[model samples]
Target: MSDKILIIDDEPGIRSSLRGILEDEGFNVQAVASGEEGLALIKRENFDVILLDIWLEGLDGLEVLKKLKEEEEKAQVIMITGHGSVETAVRAIKQGAYDFLEKPLSLEKVVVTVKNALHQKKLEEENLILRSKFRNKYQKLVGESPVIKELKKKIAKAAASKASVVIYGESGTGKELVARLIHQQSSRKNKKFIHINLAAIPEHLLPRELFGYIKGAFPEAASDKKGKVLLANGGTLFLDEIGEINPLLQIKLLHLLEKGIIEPEGSLEPIPVDVRIIATSQVNLAPLVRAKRFRDDLFFKINVLPIVIPPLRERKEDIPLLIDYYLDYFSLELGKKKKTMTSAAKKAFLNYSWPGNISELINVIERFVIMVPEDEIRPEHLSLLVEPRELQLTPQNNHILSLKEAILHFEKEYIHRRLMTNGWEVKRTAQELKVTPQELKEKIRSLGIRIAD
Candidate 1:
């Protein structure tokens, strides 16, 4: 974005001259007559840099800077005054003005100071946005399940203290979500929330990436760069898929945890960092530690507070609520009408083991809503059990049929054919027949169509 410059001066000549110069340099410039007008303009819009004149008609430059600091205290300001003095310059700097300029101002100094101040403002804005985004991304753990409630309580308990947390769960169980919640609830929420996927980064790069590197640290090093740990100073650093890290890096990680310091690549002196570590893994880290694949010291350092996310199958009671959540999400995301689950469909949802967990459920639900044009979801719509099972029309059937003789035969054929058309998933089958899982199961039972043992 082009830099926006706001010029506040009493003299029309000064305001016009500054605007012309800034505009020529490709900056969007706005000039106000007095400090009062400038303050009003500030309230209406955001500016990259401000040029404030010291001796205005009513409010002096110092007064304008003070009030501006009160509103957006971090704003970059360059003070301009005809009566330039050492005391005035010192006072301006003390009041958060970036630089003080004595009139008649050199065009070069004005341009250079404004450019540097705008660049500084841009960096600050980028850092603020990244921090805000990181905080908001972790605010989506919505559930009243006992497991979730206990998890929240635990996060609250651990957030205040400087404890390393380790989260363990299967794939798609929201392990990263749990890790972030811990960071946000902590006292360090306002600080950076740095995240890295251990599995995603290369083994050779992981060390430099986590601990940071110095200028000319290696052949490819153009300049010094702060790593995730340094970025997360005074906050939390999340190491995702920690179990997948290389064994050598595991040892280095242990060293950092023990020392509370990191020696950048090619550096001997260690840089101290005040950062809490939150590590997450899809598999149990304990086993890896025991096997010597992961360092035991590192595991202990990161396992102060442990959280495990139960699979969707284990918490079957929450399936209906999860479905509703996904339905609402997909409706808004796909721009479609609302979808509701029928009683029969809910039963089918309850019966099946969600092998892929919540992620799988979301994908299936999104497709189910978009493809199947139905007001309400029935039993056949619930894609609970997807594995193919051959059910023969035999007398000795476990699921009792609701019909008798020829009607039962026809119903059996109808259900079987529909299952074939649906590729044999309970959810798809229900959608094809415009029935719920409960209805499908009931009809299959009523007709004595049985799964062959």
Candidate 2:
């Protein structure tokens, strides 16, 4: 569609001339006789640019501009007048006018200004789209369970403040993901977000890596270097696995957290930093503090806002949703056809204990997208990757059971396994067990076996 331009002026000759020029420039031009008419037209239609004369019959151009600002109109406005002055141009610009033009307007300048305004508008729109995409990528938590909902609330409240945050979760439970979400929603989102894993860095060189030294400070110090603290000034610094830091490093970190000052390993002067600390730990710091392995002061300083992420096994109800999300995600990412899982396969997934948590689940789905060739994934395909926990009577438990109770337990397990293999189809399972469908249904009800939808 061609760009739409609105020409608002009282003089018939000026409106006609402006309309002709804009139309010749391949723009869809609409000319109006008064500001009131232009405002009414804007209410019904949208335009890319508005050319408004300063002097109108009832409502002046400035007043119309004020109304547009109140409505938050997206179109760019340019001011035109026969009697123009520097003061008028500055005021118009302050009021959000794209440009100010005199009565003897240069048609060439008009085209250039309008094109520039359009370009600026396009860039602003693209910027908004990119920011939205970035937000969705980092801010999504992908679960609707009660625990997850509460966790999101905590993250939002924590993001609004500048206090230090400490996240607690098991490995593969997305601790760093929560930290990134907090930073993305904070006031300093436009600034840097620096992350360093304490567990990944070597203990012998951690000090130099964190608090960089000046040139000639050491034999290998070739030039002045900025540490993570200094580099993350006015932004956020995420310390992953903060519990892994040694005792000496913990003391230095405590001093920095207390004074907001960082002293390089060999530097004489201490530089103050303005960094928001976000730390994560798989282990509880309180026990470590009691054991004298972690400094109490440092632990307290970084634990102002605490957030805990629940593991996948605890939220089994949300497993189906997570499976669907990852299946679609990996299919699109790998440019493969999305596959469906058989009832047996889904039952297997629900039966397994996800000890590795969401990270493990995501990897498993991605692997299926790349390796599984069939459109319908079955239990055998999944068994290649992980063995689903099955119902069994162990020797220890069997010893405590009566003879009749043991026989009933074995019967239940056998029926349940057969039903699952046949995708919960009663007739097929009954045929395999040499019984009628009605009898099989009665046995299922007596054994209290839950069927998967």
Candidate 3:
């Protein structure tokens, strides 16, 4: 079917001209003499794009746009008027109008704007479908541990409400996963769930990235840019590592939370948005607030619904279950038979503190599935992967060793652990260890540590 276009103008000539133009462009066009008629027709049918006139008989274009938004209409509206101003255009955009146009209308500009609006509408629909499918694929939170059960309860509660949430957890403890689960189960599940890592973005560029900017906002800004916050309007914005946000940005964020509006760069107009913030942080914000690094008001605002995820070390009981699940999952994913671990190796895994948490465990399991040829993974196979903290050193033995021997022993163990964590990449491990690769190679040779080719 051809794309449908609805024209709402008080002037018969303008309506007829727009209808003719759109119809000639292969659109199924409908013309109405007033906004009232256009709205009535919208109630009866669906249109891909609506060409609305600012000056109407009963209801004006802005009022109609407001009604369309209130009704949650999917059609993209392009507002047109013979008398147009920057204020009017900003007002139309703030009220969710796709684009603003002036009359005597440039027919070519209308066609291009309408096509762009239709294209955007199609992309949004496709995104919703894709998000639905993704939500269906990974809806459940794994593990039957008591902490996990309690976490699930909190998640369900958070989902049922439209409150800001701050998820506190260590790195790799699935903070993002929990955030996504909350978004998936929330009232806004059908809308977009945009995730922005505050830590990943440079501090200088963060405001523009989150709040967007108008055309020519900066030297490099050649066109208008929609930020993640606007993109997540009527949905959830997952601010990953939100603790990394600077003091200035925090104030802006606080303003957004307090007032449901954001001012794009280079524009005085503040666009109203309905965005629920779901922020994840590995660090506690209280200390940052006390230090004056983070805004206290902002912290309190976002901490309305605080959900703390226990690190894997605290929930060691879930290790076996996670191991089984990942083993089965990675085995199937890698097209290999399921692998089993010896009781001793499992004991070592449970004993070792997984500083990297669930993510580290997953990496180790995946590595084993790919590298280990045998179905039965033994303690020796885990030697390089698992840190030797499992082997407790007696106080008497420590006293027997000299200072140099103890230093050498600790250095070797630490280097080996770092190597294993970095997949034995000498360059990466050296960078992390703050040493030159050549120096690390010398240490590795002197220590007689074996590395896989």
Candidate 4:
């Protein structure tokens, strides 16, 4: 659609000429004789640009500009006058006029100014959209528990430093959330925040994904591409599941950390980068280092400011707050009326050991919002999460099983029992095990336990 232009001038000839010029330039133009008519038209319709003569029959241009500023009208206003002065132009600009024009206006100058003003407005809109997206993705870390409070304090401290951070937590424990919180509070918050999950990316493609590649680097490389490391320059690079990266990739990452340079595939020249690294892992890197699976140097490098997010089981007191948050969030999202849970349902949630942490709880709440038709969620709506059974060690099995084998067997039986007790509801069984539903499903797979009768 063409930009809408409103011309407010006392002189009929000036309004007619301005409308003709703007309309011919592919603008939808409307001419008004006074500021009163202009403001009335503005109230009824949206205009991209307004041309107002300073001296009008009633409600002068400056007065209309003040009203527009007060009302927060987004249209760009240009002040036109035969007797234009430097002081008058400055005052009009201060009053939110996009530009000031002298009488006997040059049509070319008018078109250029309007174009620039529209371009500025477009940029402002784009910026607002980007900031809104950033806020949604990097929402404030919720929870007021002691553990959460401590983590917030530590995040504040870490934000002031340039040290590499490593967040340790189980799957679904908000490791990436912590990283984003740190980045948001840091000085580089306005820059990019690039995230890469090492475990998700294939091993053969990992290097090019991190360091980028040049044109003709491989058979599929038709054009040069920028990778996460380069795209994250002067910002933060979040490496999730850092321990899953292979040793060869570890060496490349270590080189980048030590040298602040990346050699893209098929490029000999090393490009300098100024990226802050924030790595997270579900398992302890120390064991991986000791077992010779991960590099000790790399471990030391990323573990500079280690932050451990406690599991939901450890911070069970925050479960209700999380439940309420998800309930309200999903209700609004799903366009459903707010649903309250019965005391028994609440108790069931509190008693259940959440293995997947906040992530699991969010999924459960979302499911309840969609499936639970009642205004109130009752005990039956909740999954049965009985107490986890104790590991049984029979004398016959103890003699044959190694410690690792015995623990594996016990875990298999424990998960199987929970699944059966919960009537094969994966979410409930996972909560009972204090693990995510996905994690529980993985265990069922590895143990070869079939839920089918």
Candidate 4 residue-wise lDDT at 127: 88
Point to the candidate with the largest TM-score: 3
lDDT of 4 by residue, 1-453 (tens): 466789999899898888888888899899999888888656545567899888888798899999989777777898897763657767899878988889788999888988888887767755864676554522657788999999999999889999999999998888988998898789887566889999998999999999988778899998667778977777899999999999999999999999999988988778877889999989989999999999999988889999999998888788778777777778886899998776666666676556667777777787888878889987666432221222234545437878888788778766765665555567887887798978877887777653211
Give candidate 4's root-mean-square deviation (CA, Å). 15.9
What ordering of candidates by TM-score runs from best to worst? 3, 4, 1, 2
Model 1, 1-453: lDDT tens digits are 365689998889888888988899999898988888887556434566889988888888899999878755455999887763758877988989988788887888899999889778758856885656544423467577898788778878878778888888888777777776777677776555788998888788999888877767799987566677766766688989888988788777887788887777867667766778888888888889889888887888888888888888777777778878777777776789999887556665565555567766766677777766887876554333222222334446466656666465666666765663354467777877788988987776666442211
Q: Give the least accurate 10-residue stretch of model 4, judged by summed lDDT.
A: 383-392
Better of 2 and 4 by TM-score: 4
Shift of residue 59 alpha carbon in model 1, Å? 34
> Which portions of model 3 show Cα errors greater than 4 Å?
1-140, 384-453
Q: Candidate 2 regions off by >4 Å?
A: 1-139, 386-453
lDDT (Cα, tens digit) per residue for candidate 3, span 76-160: 9998867636578678998899988888788899889999999999799878857664444234467888999999999999999
- Could you tell me which 10 consecutive residues in candidate 2 have the lowest summed lDDT? 383-392
By lDDT, the candidates rank as: 3, 4, 2, 1
How high a TM-score does candidate 4 get? 0.59
Pairs that collide, model 2 = none
Lowest summed-lDDT stretch of 10 residues in model 1?
Answer: 382-391
lDDT against the true structure, each candidate? 0.74, 0.79, 0.82, 0.80
